[model samples]
Target: MTDVDLTADPLHDSPALREFFGDSYDRVARFAVMLADQGVLRGLIGPREVPRLWERHILNSAAVVPFLGEGTIVDIGSGAGLPGMVVAAMLPERSVVLVEPMERRTQWLFESAKECGIDNVTVVRGRAEEVDEVVEADVITARAVASIDKLVKWSAPLLSPSGEMVLLKGRSAGDELERGKYVLRKHGLVGSVHEAPTLEGLEATTVVRLQRQG
Candidate 1:
């Protein structure tokens, strides 16, 4: 995907995102095309998802970047590095960990980061439940990883006191939040649902934000 053309890219219309990630425009764009073409071929992305890779996948992942504060990011179930790789490509200054137990997926993540020119990413081979001992992060990111309940159980221990879990969900985000409310409260975490901050007039992604309760 080197030297890919960016004319009329769907993300071009999102000035706020573009301006925020201005320096990483090329890297992010190349990563998107690579994920759509090569990533699909490798069984990383669904074949039918190629057409929507930009808005539905890459942009959706990158949308979470704006909501993130400066700190290390741990991405669980980092299959194909959805929000992880995309975020790593855009924000190279931040430490991004892509955690997955599958060797195939972790291998792809390492190679993909190299191909995408992302230097701030580290690929760790482990499940979300097993990495807490050595992995502490300020923000935990997930996309289509697991149910809300399981996500919290696996991710909570890895979060620092001020850490937040930023998860990407579909239209059922509100429902998931409601269903997970008991677990959130049980774990002393507060949950809120918000429209993924993205370009105007576009179908926004849903975000579930969780913070440690006082």
Candidate 2:
């Protein structure tokens, strides 16, 4: 993890990130800085990630919000609350559950949520595979957690019967979607890949949306 100087925060002047975050600008920036600082100390986030907070983390995370529906959204392995906390702040009407297995990470999430003044989030200290409450979520999301197949395997059962999943994939989104085709079918779910546009001119992000077909 690289070290970051909190005083010279990059998120402060990123017009795109501020626009992307809208009214939650202050809290969101604070969260980004806090995560970059304490997150590296705790080994939750790479210290190098602090500089790329907007384009790499925040935008990619916030872009998926448009594809989501109103309901409970469960973020698997919500380390440092990438998309979970971001989503919670983006849409207060939608409930969010951040599932993290490590106590330290979960503590960071709770404290960050409180300090950042985000109220629509719940931190659950457990893995997605073994947690039953997660199965009741209306939607499931994750970023940099695991392969798409594994994510679907652990999270598919957690969705409400009619719920869908919107996962943030890397540049290899298409390849990953192809690779996970079997798992999606095996779970009796329908999956599709689409682009999530965050910054207009910048490259669009690949997002996979899944739902029960049966």
Candidate 3:
């Protein structure tokens, strides 16, 4: 008998995911398939990530969709387009810009957006701090990109007057927030952490929201 790897079928759909994604389910699912197939080869996501692509990467990325209010969204260091492309897929009406430094990664993003039929996506190849001044963002998002302090510094310039940074963080979110308090204050920003929901069984995503001090 041959052993079958269930993880190989990462796009196993669930009621919660279908309900959450609604009309955008097909596109997001296609994107996931692409990642599972080419993510490691393109050096975007590690091979180990393929097993839990839906829970860890796709659904976790979708957690940010609720908090994203009106206007353009800019995702920094959007390797494999985690929340960036995911967000674009879910919210087809909203403009989502993916900023990635590597040329190959940028190509992946562009190709994924095109092949997945995500029309609201724009791929920009540049470091977060070096992105063009014309690209003003109403909401900025990033996942596993950098420390809180560094993220704030890199995202500050691109933010619009009332823009906020909602970053996907991990268990050390609070500690990072504490350490970054000074830098946040220096940038005239304030930070808070929230537990954003994905599916019922899976752990909630840690999101750190940073906005200018009013």
Candidate 4:
């Protein structure tokens, strides 16, 4: 499959989007389009469902930028780097580690990072639960990864004492949070959910932030 044609007009010269993304706008947009064209996303979500590349994918991913602090970011189950690689493109100051067990997806993440000239991202090929290492990060992000309960257990050790876990969930975020309450308490992490802006009829996106207690 071929990469998306990023030189297309609308995205190439949109002042508003350019301002929002800064110098990294074009590269991030290009990466989104490339994923669509290359069929990488199609394998998981299918072609027709691919939302508007610039507004829905890139912008939605970039929206998380403001919440991230300077440090390492570990993206759990980064299937094609939705917000992970997208964040890396926009925030060069932060390091992004994409932890995906699937070999194919990990390969794609690595290739996409190289293609986008994003040096701060590293793709690790392993499941989140099995890989036990003491890599404390300032932030941990997961998009459509799993239930909040499972995620907490999986990501608890990866976070530093002050690190925050930002999980992306759909409308059922509240339900997930409730389901994960037991695990959250057991792990000594306080959890809260925030609403993200709507995109492509996606009414509510949830950002679940968790911090470790003393």
| TM-scores, each model vs. reference | 0.89, 0.90, 0.94, 0.86
lDDT of 3 at 168: 93
Q: Model 2, residue 89: what's the lDDT?
A: 82
Backbone clash count, each prediction separately = 0, 1, 0, 0
Residue 110's lDDT in candidate 1 = 84
Model 2, C-alpha of 145: deviation from truth (Å)? 0.9
Tens-digit per-residue lDDT, 30-143, candidate 2: 677677768778887677766666777877788899888878888999987989988888887777899999998899999999988889898888989789753478888999
Candidate 3's displacement at residue 191, Å, is 0.8
TM-score, prediction 4 = 0.86
Alpha carbon deviation, residue 95, candidate 1 (Å) = 0.5
Q: Write the per-residue lDDT of candidate 4 for residues 1-214, one digit (tens) a residue.
A: 3433434424444677777677887677667666767743437445553544555566666666666766789888888687889989988877888889999888888888888788899888887776658456789888877888888888888877788888777767888888888898888888777776633444445577777776
Candidate 1: tens digits of C-alpha lDDT, residues 1-214 = 6323333354542576566568987788767766765776788877677655677777789888877786999999999888998899888889999999998888888887888788899888999889888899899999988988889988899998899899998888878888888889888999888887665666888888898887
RMSD of 4: 3.1
Report per-prediction Cα RMSD to one decimal: 2.6, 2.8, 3.0, 3.1
At residue 8, give the lDDT of candidate 2: 54
